[model samples]
Target chain A: MSQVLTIDGKDLAFDSGDTLFDVAQAQGIYIPHLCHHPDYPPQGNCKLCTVDVDGQSKCACTTQAETGMSVQTDSTTLTEYRRALTELLFSEGNHHCPGCERSGNCQLQATAYAQGMTYSSFKLLNPQRQIDASHPSVLLDRDRCILCGLCVRASAQEGKHIFTIAGRGSDSTLAVNSDSGLLADTNLSAEDRATQVCPVGALMVKQQGFRIPIGQRIYDQGTIDDLGNRRPQYHSPKSKTARIAGDSDD
Target chain B: MTESTTDSRSLTRVAIDPLTRVEGHGKVTLLLDENQVVQQARLHIVEFRGFERFIQGRPYWELPMVVQRLCGICPVSHHLAAGKAIDMLVGAEQLPPTAEKTRRLLHFAQVLQSHALHFFHLSSPDLLFGFSSKASERNIVGLLEKHPETALKGVKLRKFGQQLIETITGKRVHGSLVVPGGINKALKPAEINVYAKQMDEIIQWSTEALELAQGLYQADRKHADFGAIGSPTLSLCGNNGNFELYHGDLRVKDIDGTILLDHISNRDYLAHIEEEVKSWSYMKFPFLKRLGKDRGWYRVGPLARVLNCQQMDTPLAERARLELVNQCYPDQHQSVLLYHWARMIELLHCAESIQQVLKDSELTGGELVAPHGDRNPECYGIIEAPRGTLIHHYKVNDQDLVEEANLIVSTTSNNQAMNEAIRSVCRQYIDGHGVSEGLLNHIEVAVRAFDPCLSCATHALGKMPLSVEILSVAGHETQVLERTSQGEIQQRFYPC
Candidate 1:
């Protein structure tokens, strides 16, 4: 038997082995975060997940739950820090969310809203990205990439190395094997890139244009957020990662 | 103990994660002795494409569009294969007369592009340069740097094919217009003339390309030994017994050089052929297993086509093919190594096929798709896409909803044999003492010998990983979904 914990003076109950974030979720409370998909590997690198625990700011994903523990999800201090973190990530890459295709569905946009971020203080990194129209199935717009390395990881771990990161940290980007330096020359296949995985418009369907009517678009009937980022909530069954992860959930 | 000696249990297994520089991700493992004699070879065809069975509930017209998703590199193949099968299922004469001509043109266009891709992209590396180039320069770029004129010719030829595909199907890659029972559009005479011009240029260039291949063959003899799957190669060139690329009578030859099958109607394939399931791979091997042999590995596609046909239509390709056969000494090498040379020869033939089809009487002006009063309850289709022979069979019920489907793609035709070819290369080339990227790549590329649309052969990409929960279908009145990726379930409200 595990004792219940209180967060922000409210009683929250969870299983003994649940992570802090998992416990927070069971209470119907949320903490602003990105790079923390339940199905994907959690790195807690977003830094926006900082929460107040014993007067210390810590990531909720990696930290374990404790009995009689008191915590706050959105304190004044934590909110300010999270907003700052969002602003910096925005400035680090050329994530012009408004014009981006991934604008509505992107995690970066969702995190910014959650933290109540208004604007950025730092200038944009303004990295140049090549749009490959070679492979007929999908397109890869590099400028929108936040370097979350989700695609890189997906291609390597799940995709089993059909794609790879060719360079070093800041200098690195996902590169295909074709000499054309574009997807057209590489061996990138349709199944390699599913339509719904990308949060932003960075990866768009190339071959089938406007076949998905605006009324029936993925974002049309329900905002995944309003629906919840859980199965039948945040995840689309067509996503390769979501589908692969679905087995473990069962 | 048979030939090569030493530790028997320690077989060298090479895991080419995503096996690069080839179509689809799959791996090959080889068992051998210290003496280097090969034992068992297994090809793990990992991507599950179940295209054959997925179309049971879909519209007959959507089959071509859906089937096109099977291969990213050769969408036109499935589109044409499905179209041909649907046309036959409705009875060829029942189809709108113009539909047949348009389908043929589309088929030729696909052959042109696919054959060109094989020569330029898949097989050229081995022929244009040493098969193992450490320079890491492997692509059209590499081809251009070494031989600019040849690369340009290939680009032009392939582009011409794409133009024709786009013109007829309305899109370049995943074309959706080719309908069952008939086509969706017709090739205009003006468009036909342009295609003819492009075909003329392609014919000249591909002929020269074949000549260059002949010149290169004297220097490259090893390629002649690739994919020599036991005995006679399974082939589907043209039923006319000509080395044509469009319609064909399916044929299989035994190792004794006897024709086991001279004609195979699409409806009879199931009774004559059967697919064997293997736990080691996702690909199901189709064999004349009904013949009661040890599940004989049957092959169909380029190598099979070259072995099956004795004559080609294009004068230039016919001459080159004759020369290619004469040069092989014992003549059996025609199926073994000629797949590479045959692609170039087909490029020459496709160039001619494209030119002739464009001149057909119906393409100048005629109706495209035929009238569909209702869905046919059952139909079967078989046509030659660039990859090889393709088959689609469907069964529909009273309301015209689909009931059952079975597909046999060109890739399935070679599944078991591909495993055999990989082992042969492993024993001959790979060094277990160390990992040789070069040796590993050549063997992997050998699977490309069939140019399989791993996904296309499986079916298409519209597949969803749906998790169906069968909660005792509520009552005995619940309908049985005879076919579903989700297994069968009975109706009952038996709760936990």
Candidate 2:
């Protein structure tokens, strides 16, 4: 009924269909991740969740759990590689934590904190990007986007189909699937799952900024390791009907 | 000091642009005549943030959060005002009793914190230390160094208010607690008990603070008249003619204490009041309709509120107000410096109200939020912010997306009054030969008396720091006074 896998020298059991990420999360083992929500299908776009399995580097989110597999999660090599990936993600966007409203709540920022990234090693790519406030309720800050496509995937899952990637590689950008290319034209409400799925501050709900006082945000309450339960409820299927704790204030 | 040469070229101008020790950015410009007489003075709001234009196309429900970004210092005022507006848009005028009580408590906390900040952090430095003390010494640091115990009490008092905000709204700067029809979360018994305990200390500290402020005021009666000027007053009062901050009808009164306009609905503010936009400043000057622009310019904030209201609801504040009016001043205290006394009185009222609200068990009721109802096309929300009356108007489409938005913030209402006060102070103190730091401080005292929020008035984009300059003629720069990052005033004489 269940299979065993040795992760970081600890034996853990998994079901036949469970991905390596599911097994680690179920076993209370944290493999730093971004672009990998439990409710959504596994996507390996972000290579930050990579782990050494049987002497081969595999993405924990997309890779299926196998029997008797020796996985090295927190090894020095893996830690260094994950740090570089997080650093690369940081460099690719303007991730100014102090200025960003989503600093404490952001999964990317939380993952970077978990990876012990005190500082970014890569050169800063301070790309000049447009902040689209045309939508009224939501602000589309392209500068904060890391191209994870979480909003796109979440919207498609909800049958909204309002978000999509429009280009290839570095040129690829998140585009609203509307003729006007603005959120106002779409039927996106403030309570949409797509609005909650942003790993960064890219798709922010306006006026909700700076509401959560500093020194008492998600990270301030507990480390990411202990704050897994407090993540944005985009992963919950009933999120549409479920009243978000802070959503009502806006 | 030697008399300056009487020539247009020799005349000097003093500018305190990006005024320090207050929220947001504003500047005071004084022009001296050829005879060394002060000709004119103006307070210019230099920043403009077009939030009304940019908020179009947003869902009406998001307005509370969207508008609160206008000023960091008074986000709660905007947040609650926007929340009230959205409540009207959603057709929920009579909110649940529990929700009403909760919002009332939140409003009290906001007033307490804002007043604490204004009195302790911003104004107390000038009051505690002599106004003409060293630029570096007449600040919070100086207060901390000289009066550490008093400074600590102020800090703790401000913290208590912020802590109350955090307890209710979940954060202080821009708490996302209040919604369209009601608040997001219900108060827990544990949270209520904690605040109830803390209120005792807060009340005690506030009482002592009132006593201290009165003593300070009495110490320098002459200096208190630095910015005193005669102006008509406009404020909001409760339905029963009682002092009100959260909800009220707009009322206007003349300089001689005669009621000009009475019991006007806030929704019809545009019909009763008009804004005159001047080319020299970004802030629009608001004046009453019947009196017209020339005589209609009126003062707001504590001075106006105290003068217009018949009674205060709280006992401690009522006694304080009676004592203040009967002994220290007349029925309508026109002196700008009395604002400090009125502010302290209101602070005491807020503290007592906090206690009164916390004791009520209805605050912990189960109904935390109201169900969404049919939407309206347009609505207006008005509330008395800490500085003065604030108004937010929004028009929405059938889909509930914001089509147009307009805001007449607290500081904007006092723009003409502030300019008039500055003109009066300049004429009284400045006698050419440029201006001394002491006189400039006196000029700043006039503007500070209103406790203006230039950021909310101008709604400017990005951060603005304070700086002052003195110019001769049109093109020639003479002197500059800039606020360093440490908030100390730095003097620089520019080569002509």
Candidate 3:
């Protein structure tokens, strides 16, 4: 029997083992997530998709939908929490939006805009990060990374196992699995799912930046609420089989 | 601080800090003796932003977009200049015809809008209402209240230019259009058509604005002598020695219209140009290396371009240029006020050029980027920004990150000339008078004629204020007068 749950006062039906996020997404309700991609196993690292389930705040991406469960996807308290989480993400890294190639198309930037986050109130860490551009077709700028692990999962799913998260807590960073710690030594190609799954400018294809123009960019057309996880795909010569994240079935 | 000029009389220092109606923060100081005779005058730029150092260790391709942060008023100029430099870095000696034309179009729009803004909004009040008019009456708001039609036309003209930039570059300010070897996108015919339909109105408005500036200059005899100083002028000229805003060799002309240097290439700029660091100001003084610092100081911008170039390429601007030349009998063009007239003529030229470029079929369809050439370590991008000549020089290491960067912005190039202009104004108007509103306005008017961008010159960022401090003969603070960034004036006196 199909399980029914109440989300934001709407009764939604879901199958067994389906997460609250997946059920809401299937019913055309966007939970405003960054690290949670539909194609990959929900990591629930970014708690932006926090919802009040039965008077308890929980990560919608990890919480399984149950029969007769009440879930509030959005509220004043949840918005404040989401905004604080977004601000913390910004303050934890050096995110210079103007200089970033993914400025208008970045999901992090779009999500921040949707949450009405104009500036970060927390003290910025300004952590120094590394840039790995050894790969001819792709560049890895750790400064823009949010530790989404989408790339780590995507690379593992592709059987390349090129990316892995290293360190812990505030020191955690997206690291390459190659022995030399360089992207050139990895088996990842520009067409690899790992290269295509980056939600930010962390893993960008070389020579394809600022091509879509400003107003025509993914987020520029509409807010993240209106266009959830839709990115303008730039097809490189070697990117014939590359797919945009959340667009194709796993 | 005050200095004793003679046994009986001592020099009192008067400073106008944070000069108003300009892009950045700067000040002017004059020393007066007991007789109220002007002893010395200097323009001080107060902040420094080391942009060249900031770009170090970054990839070379990012220079075009990265350098736009230098100035909000003229980011397009920086973008294009850096693009030209990056083109050389990637070994693109020649851009595709379409790429070249598109860049030119963007530059013309930039110049058009910048000139309109300076004239209609920044300096028009002084010209229309008189430089010595009531402080409250000499502003954009005042202009709008009295002359709404003219103010509206100025706004629309500036809007047209900005919209044109947005259409081409995507965003109005700090937008990305130029890439390494060429532009990122082509100008579609529909986009061209949108601007093409507005060309007639744009040209008409520009022509009317030019007439207003000319009429104002002719009507006021005082303008002829206001801040007049003799100096050598510099700008870029076409291969044939015609007025060229984009892609040209350097040309320098003396006060007598003698060519000091001509056809100097961008790569050889180091050999011809050099910057001198001064103890007082963050801005550097750039002059012709051949002439040395004492004599090499030259003027730049619309006045310099008009004086240095032989003729304008477009017919309308050429006619206006000739009229200006005829009005300035021999040495009359040396008047600082002529910058407004020359700037309006260039505005007309840009308007005509924009219309001409839109008709070009190459913009609709052609090769976007040029084929790569042998990569080089060092390259220079030089272009005539709205204010004056802008130079961007960069050297990249083997890893493609920028190893070094040196920029000589337009305002920095005119630093020495601005000081000279202020000195001339002090000697002419403030020689025997106390610090009055009219006298202070005269000083500001002199500096405004140059259309200086202190922010771009210092590579700094912040709002600017105007303050006047009177120092006693003993070097003790006697009185202070300040004009805040919000245009509020506060005066304080200290008992000796």
Per-candidate alpha-carbon RMSD to the true structure = 21.3, 6.2, 3.5
DockQ for candidate 1, C-alpha atoms? 0.01
Cα lDDT for residue B382, candidate 1: 73
| lDDT-better candidate, 2 vs 3 | 3
Chain B alone: TM-score in each candidate? 0.82, 0.91, 0.94
Measured by DockQ, the strongest candidate is 3
Enumerate the candidates' DockQ scores in order.
Answer: 0.01, 0.15, 0.40
Residue pairs that clash (backbone atoms under 3 angstroms), model 3: none
Instruction: Supply the DockQ value of model 2.
Output: 0.15
Score candidate 1 by lDDT: 0.59
Q: What's the TM for model 2?
A: 0.80
- What are the runs in model 1 whose C-alpha is more than 4 Å off? A1-250, B1-12, B20-23, B34-37, B88-94, B237-239, B290-295, B327-336, B369-376, B431-434, B452-496
* DockQ: the better of candidates 2 and 3: 3
lDDT of 3 by residue, B1-496 (tens): 1212244236788888666323556777788877787777878877777889988877676788788888888899999999899888879869888989999999999999899888887788888888777656677778889999999999899999999999899888899887777877788998999999999999999999999999999897878887787778889999999998888899998777888899999998889888888788888888788889888888889988887888988899999999987766478246788899999999999999999999998886998877777887899899999999989999987656788999988888888887887777877777777777577678777777886454222211112355678899787888887655555567888987
Rank candidates by TM-score, best first: 3, 2, 1
TM-score of chain B of 2: 0.91
Candidate 1, residue B125: how far the Cα is off, in Å:
2.0
